[model samples]
Target: MSEKTSASRRAFLRTGLAGGLAAGGAALAAGAARADDPLITDLEAQPWTQYLGDGVDAAPYGLPSEHEAHVVRRNVAWLTADPVSSVNFTPLHELEGIITPNGLCFERHHGGVAQIAPSEWRLMINGLVERQLVFTLGDIMRFPRVTRAHFLECAANSGMEWRGAQLNGVQYTHGMIHNVMYTGVPLRHLLEEAGLKGSAQWLLPEGGDAAGMTRSLPLEKALDDCLIATHMNGERLRPEQGYPARLVVPGWEGNMWVKWIRRIEVGDRPWHHREETSKYTDLMADGTARRFTWEMDVKSVVTNPSPQAPITHGHGPTVLSGIAWSGRGAIREVHVTTDGGINWHQARIEGPSLDKSMHRFVYEFDWDGAPLLVQSRAVDSAGFVQPTKNALRKVRGVNSIYHNNGIQTWAISSEGEAENVEIS
Candidate 1:
């Protein structure tokens, strides 16, 4: 090699080394600046970092962290006469994603939770069938199994807000619902095994609890997407969720999904039980009643920045998140408005868009810390848009307590506190 080429190569190597050293020095200065943050500087001094955690055997069954103890199901004492026959609300504001944790799923009991031995559980198919059939839990599990995700919503959810906004928190007003994946055998497969008689038109599913909660379902719907479920969210059903077995009636109200389900009696006519005639029916202004109202309408609620979950971070870049669902189909879109209904921005829907399941959505914006009114409107695949409270009252007359799917509004102060409010 020539001396001139060697000298140029040596100079290029020296310059490259100097440039690399400068970049390294700049990175070191940035790291020194970040060292001032207490979270980074003191992290090694924390107990969790310095000490070993509990062994795996310490928690035989896993549990939530101590910091998350506040995330729980809550019940309103005045909502019912006694705790046994009351309903509890899910902590919707504290949850994320589309699926609700099994432990935190909202519960509604007419006679409290019934604890039954799986070995003694029996599902009897009687009336209007070629043969009376009784299948044990073991026998039911032997059939072909299927899994599906669905949302179960009580008919009376948000019932208290029919007249006006009475609940201060979204947990109490919109928490009587949960979405979970169920594993079970199709009801049609079981009915086919039992041989449904030609005269069969209706089915009466009775619960094993003391109240013996029973509801009449149409034969067509029963054969469509119903299931005799034994598992939820990949685990055995919880005691409050019906232990041994339960019924799944997709896209329908929760009353029809009988927990601790024991019997299915085929009949030719509807059985106007107390729950159907006196309890679940919607009273109209003309002294009439709307009965057999099964499906839950398209609904959405802003879970975060709610009354219980106030925005404590003050102003700056803010994240607004919520959930929307529909019994008819999937949620196609969700629109959020910060100035009541003056302006609406389409929220980005995240997670899976399953049919008859909850859909999570998020909207990010810069906040000026001004007093604002927050609201969300949902549009479902069926093209049904969520209505306002006053618009719903104009048609339904506020004489009933069931099936209130109106849009909810939360008034936010400059301080970031939120409260339930209805806008005209």
Candidate 2:
């Protein structure tokens, strides 16, 4: 190393440092200029500023910001024949945190969302109960009210991918679920009001929709944590949801949470309804079907790097985030695998960690523009670990369409786009 070469290198380093400092100073100056001469600097001159704001009665019913118009329930046209007797998925990718907003929550109706007036709603307890009693909306509201948060997940949440990765977005694959704080009277109180007959072992809750959806719930569950909810999140239940009142079976299949609940008929046996018999049941390849599978297994999905939400920032510090939940209990932990299933890392679970509620989890890492396979695995408090598609298939078979809690895999290309992929 000659002195002349060393001097030249030293001079280059000094020039580079000065240039960098000057660029940073220029950025600061630009920021200061923007602060001084902001787009809204002359607020008084603007139309909104010049005119008085709309009066309190302008919008009697409040609505979300116009910018949030995209955040709403979406339905797959091909999935069902008619919109009336169909399902709409929640916009999970557009949502954050645990609670699913009332309007944004997914809607599934056998016949259609019944538009029943609160004043006209009536709940009747009959069948095996000692006394057959009918309680109006006012009468039911008189009972002790309690608020609880729980996730109501459809049994067929990820059923489309049970055979393979068919869906393109998180909303299609995992949006048939929602968590909300329900304010209502405990179902036990109502059952106690109409003393349960000793022979009562099952309770069949029937909806008031045109199709009259009905499902047989176990007596133990009815007496435990079930609720007859009237409000969701902080507002009255949406029309799509069971407005006025709906049965809430926490930590169970969403179907069992009968919306527009009208009747609770206690019985000694489970009614093999069309829902439980021909539909929700998981059929095996061996010609046998799993029945009464109400509880949703532990599951999680990476919402950020999913197909709908691709990585756009290029290589650097990246946050991989998603939600995990269980029908059994609170999510104990969530694991993320960036290099496929070969390597696994524990994700940080952010909470309120309420029982049977959605939990957010995040895994941060440095990406270097590498093509990768991203996946998330959840473990519930019941110690049930989420299984892979292959593992789930080996046990339940490919014919089964429900309870697909398989670890979802998202393949990220070198260009930073992501797609749903099934890996061996």
Candidate 3:
């Protein structure tokens, strides 16, 4: 590479870092040389250690680098009167590799984080059950267990965008969603143990948190794939994440995943609680509301090329990557757009793209840096292509939040800085 080009690439690295690209520049620089270049090449020319610090010097539990301190879950202080009733956003700009760390997953609580003990914690299953059973945490352990990685998304995520782009980064706009591996007993095992009666069709699950969140769920889902998880990513649950126990309602809104779960009452009808009724309802532009909208529509976002992450490679084989997901099933396709919505190229999906799970996708491109716009559209196993923000606005009419699965665009300048912007 010429000195001028090398200088330019270094400048791009700094520009991209400040703009918020999740992948570290130094790591990229270390391995920048193309493979099969020359067997006699000296690796000392690289910036990072070929094999970083050993054992204890490295994290016992891995963590993002110290340079990534700005990446964190943040909540708007005034979103609620107190922190107890607030929401925190996951640092989408600072995360990579799909699985969000257990400690940094966003939190939304109506009543502060609950402190519950597994010893004293007991789940009562009653209502339409053949025999009302109150089972302690120990009783739950007796049932067979299953493991899976699923994303939990709060329904009210991106609520601030109704009046245009109120928040700056994707962290606030799309951080409400997080993917994690969980180990727990399936909901079916518990319901089977309680012996659901023939009339049992729905369940009213209640949480032990101060919020006392409760929601009615179909028996079909309860028996299908839901889990009662106590561990995330092989560690004890964090206090803010409902430590002792939490109901894992797969592919559904987070509100229904009752945290610090305490009771399950099988019922015949949906119990319209404060969360399901008054709060989560979507106010449409037609002056009507969309209620009981539980299924999170298939959605995808380009995490890089946003304010938190920007193109720092200056026009070489730049790797563009992002995450795609669907509540319906596995992501079948992820299309990338570099020219706003005018043109799009399908990204190569990599890693485990499981059903109802987060799928990481990447597209390599040479960027000229001339003003650019980027977005990612996901097509799920159901063949549902993620819609653009304008398309969503045309139908939903930018009225409210509940399911804003619209494709988001990131505007990039010649200098490589990026910011959130919406385009047709």
Model 1: worst 10 consecutive residues (lDDT sum): 8-17
How far in Å is the alpha carbon of 100 misplaced in model 3? 0.9
Counted clashes in each candidate structure: 0, 0, 3
* TM-score for each of the candidates: 0.91, 0.88, 0.86
Q: Deviation in angstroms for 184 in model 2?
A: 1.1
- Residue 178 Cα positional deviation in candidate 1, in Å, after optimal superposition: 0.6
lDDT tens readout by residue for model 2, 31-131: 35444443367775577767778789877988888867867888888988898888889888878888888888898998988999988999999999889
How much lDDT does candidate 3 score?
Answer: 0.81
- Candidate with top lDDT is 1
Give candidate 2's TM-score.
Answer: 0.88
Instruction: Please give the lDDT score at residue 85 for candidate 2.
Output: 81
Residues 225-300 of candidate 1 have per-residue lDDT tens digits of 9999999999999999988899999879998899999999999999999889999999987889999999999999
Candidate 2 residue 361 Cα shift, in angstroms, is: 0.8
Overall lDDT per candidate, in order of appearance: 0.90, 0.87, 0.81
lDDT of 1: 0.90
Candidate order by TM-score, decreasing, is 1, 2, 3
